[model samples]
Target: MKTSNGRKLSHAALSLTVLGALLGAAPDSHALGTQGACQDNHIPVALAPGLPADQEVFARLCLPPGQTPATVQLLIHGITYSHLHWDFPDPTGHTQRYSYVSAALDAGFATLAMDRIGSGKSSHPPGATVSIDSNAYVVHQVVQALRAGQVAGPSGAVGFQKVVLVGHSYGSFTSWYEASDYRDVDGVILSGVSHTIQLTSPLRVLVPLYPAALDPAFFGQGYDLTYMTTQPGTRYGAFYAPGQADPAVVALDERTKGTVTDTEFSPFAVILARPLDIRVPVLLVNGAEDRIFCGPTLSGTVCSSAEALIAAEKPRLGAQVPCVEAFVLPGAGHDLNTILDAQQWFAVAQSWMTRRIGAGADQTPGCGP
Candidate 1:
């Protein structure tokens, strides 16, 4: 499916052409609104890790005002961002209240947002043949095509009995290896990453990257030299926080930036020495001045609050990951969703996605004594 006017339809011609104008529109909706149905799939993953699935990943999904929400968030965006780092357009109307997809569709939830296959509008292939387990096996094939409804849109192909994932910074290391090697999500958020990383903060985020075919905002855009980005105006010192950002959202994040590959930075030290079982119900936020995981230089991990980031990340999460919440945000950095308090960290991640995976019976009050 496709329809941001590029026009190639079919998911039965977008369920009989725009499914009754995207489920009978009743328009007075404003905060980043256009009411329901926002389709633009692509899907077909696998361009690496055990290859052969062809390309595409793109995503988008949406859905809210006109229901169809049994819970779905997905998202991802990070290293040089796309899926516009969770919907941040802000064309100088002064930070559209820092949209985490308009605060997760005003908290009703059903988001998607992808583009991690070598960033935006997916499929880029040869940037050292992408990795981080091929972007966690292309987000576990878009989380089994959003739980087998096959990811279509314009009101067709919907499916989700619960899926959370979220992510950020290197898409939070591809959502901690796709929820710890595909247990198939039910909840997990992550956000600017941390299982503790700050030793020279990966050489200060790889010393302001380089080749997105030599960034003039991706000139000629045929990307090679292993993709990458960040250089011109160094996005207010590699990603805001000093003076809590804004400069027109750091020049519209160096004009819609996206790209990062050299095999996704060498597997983050063997996936942080393997041990994030990720059973579900996890949160993690960050950016309490996160100079690549808290520290302006090199000071180990302690984001200063939220009980010092869940006592420096709850003993490296895994014991069936039942309750792991952590937030921080404060004077944001590490691109905390384009700063300016970012809707106070998207209301603490949509109130922990409505008390641990929305709608009834999963209260998630674990991790206490």
Candidate 2:
């Protein structure tokens, strides 16, 4: 009896060792693959060589434990933020978190977000012009690096021939630029974008407050820029939010002070010129209350940013871009795309990205009940 028991124990140990080896070799990570845990994924790696002191790169890994895919969507965060905007954070060498990634994971897709050059933990390499094109190049370089080299981060798997490029706000500028410039991008999601404008606005300085309040015609005079020193989130969401931004993103407006913005990057221009000869469809989501991108002018008339942009881009796609779906949910404010209108947004993504990427249509969801 003792001899038999010893032999059984030995076999168990051997089995455990083999399992460990397999886990190590597997391309997916258990840390990030938390089934339905509200966790944000993270990877700290250098995006490029010789980054500046203020910048560093972080790769967000959003893959479930048992499953793995060679290709996944690369999520680009908004301006002044890091990839951490996707999930809840864990203390283990991770910062910044977002809930959107978890939703995507539930949909059976993985996401990887990189810290842009001058933001967060990314190494902001000096001597590099921080324009929309350069930002696009940064993402392009990250994609190439991921493909060229075998980077087995938490996701375990590496090398995506192409990825779904997703961007919001300023990130959309770079994302559209990339989607147009690169062939590997299978699709793109431009959230809160539609029209190109001469946006070097001195008025963007006020946030967590109403820009209309600043326009002399509406509120009657020049308010101090300092009024936006807090409640930036509120300011942004007021015009952009479908709901109230409480404690409201009070970063106090004015994030980009003197950052050399490239006025040349025009969404309308890109669409009209059909610059990238793009073949992939674009999913545009605008918050019903978002005024920054698509809002009513003081003239009391609604100016449709998404409408104007799609109008310009439709001809270029001409059976190639496939479909353009715009969803304006009721009672939902801008920035609500990730929160309030979650269901519709998810459906739009799944349908187009998974089933109807090549089918052209003017399917605009949530324009009503």
Candidate 3:
């Protein structure tokens, strides 16, 4: 089966079954061990200046065991993903191998994984109503709620002394927008994204997208044809580096892939152009073979290594951010969290958070070999 863009669509039905299987598995037993509680919450927040009316954002707060954590990590997923991306369930039941939430829990940090307004279980408004600025406002409100202890958890109202915003891909862009304007977060960790789009055109060619309404999976949920989604079987090609991601993980991704609003893509340049005026520590993590951001497709540029990729983005962040660090995960692609060595990236992020934001476990040099 081929779409209008000529991309083949195979194994979509099989992928959907794979998704069901993964979702059917019980939540990780380690998600809330003796150390802390993981509470699912729906937070109502008003949209930002240029967006639509208020909506409820769905989030799961993972509290540290025993004592209240002074700092919390607020997680945001990118295009075509939800909170599930943060704590991906391994079909094989390997807790330590497949989950970033597990890694963070082991490191003794609280995590609040959220689904953006238009994605996941969060309220699905019109596609035009979601943008980077508006999503940033939603995140800012969530941060305020965390600080004020206004968000109601299962145990009770929950709050944190410090908050760090962690985002992947489009989520990273939203994080940059939040830290730039609100400056409320203690630290920011951006994964699966960068300032450059060297091969964006090629990526567009490869991942041919169609209307969400056209997809049989999401036809009648109030999403119009304007909401775009990648054709079946394209995710692995676009997101996973060659021979890097596990076959099972890739199958799960195809099954659970979400949608991207046209509004979100149109205003992306405006969002990316804005300078991040964050005064807190910032970390940028990208896959070494990321096709969109750091691949060898830029007409006149060379970004063949992780250091070169990070160097391209450093100057764009501006000098206001106090400390900035970058790590490129070897043999990974755009979806760093789902790759085989995702735990290693999580360790690196935890280390950075501990050193900069005073959250998580003691610092360990987890980036390099």
Q: Of models 2 and 3, which has the larger TM-score?
A: 3
Tell me, by TM-score, which candidate is best.
Answer: 3
Candidate 2 wrong stretches, greater than 4 Å: 1-56, 88-98, 155-157, 196-202, 205-242, 246-276, 295-309, 312-320, 337-340, 357-369
Cα deviation of 94, candidate 3, in Å = 3.1
lDDT of 1 by residue, 128-245 (tens): 8787878888898888888888887665788877788888877877888888888888888887777666677787777888888876656786878888888877767876746376
Give the alpha carbon lDDT tens digit for every residue of 68-173 in model 3.
Answer: 6678889999888888888775554434465576677778788888899889778887778788877899999899989999765546776787888999988998
Per-model lDDT: 0.72, 0.46, 0.72
Ordered list by TM-score, greatest first: 3, 2, 1
How many clashes in candidate 1? 0
- TM-score each candidate: 0.32, 0.61, 0.85
Candidate 3 residue 54 Cα shift, in angstroms, is 3.1
Put down candidate 2 lDDT per residue, 1-369, tens digits, no spaces: 000000111323333432443343221222332443222222333333465323334465555334454456677766544554443222222211214565565566656766665554454444234456667766776666556534344423355544677776667767767766765566777765545332422244233333223433223333223211223233443333435432212121222111111232223354324454456667776555455555344432122444544664455443566566555544445454334345565556655555433211232211121
In candidate 1, list every pair of residues with a backbone clash: none
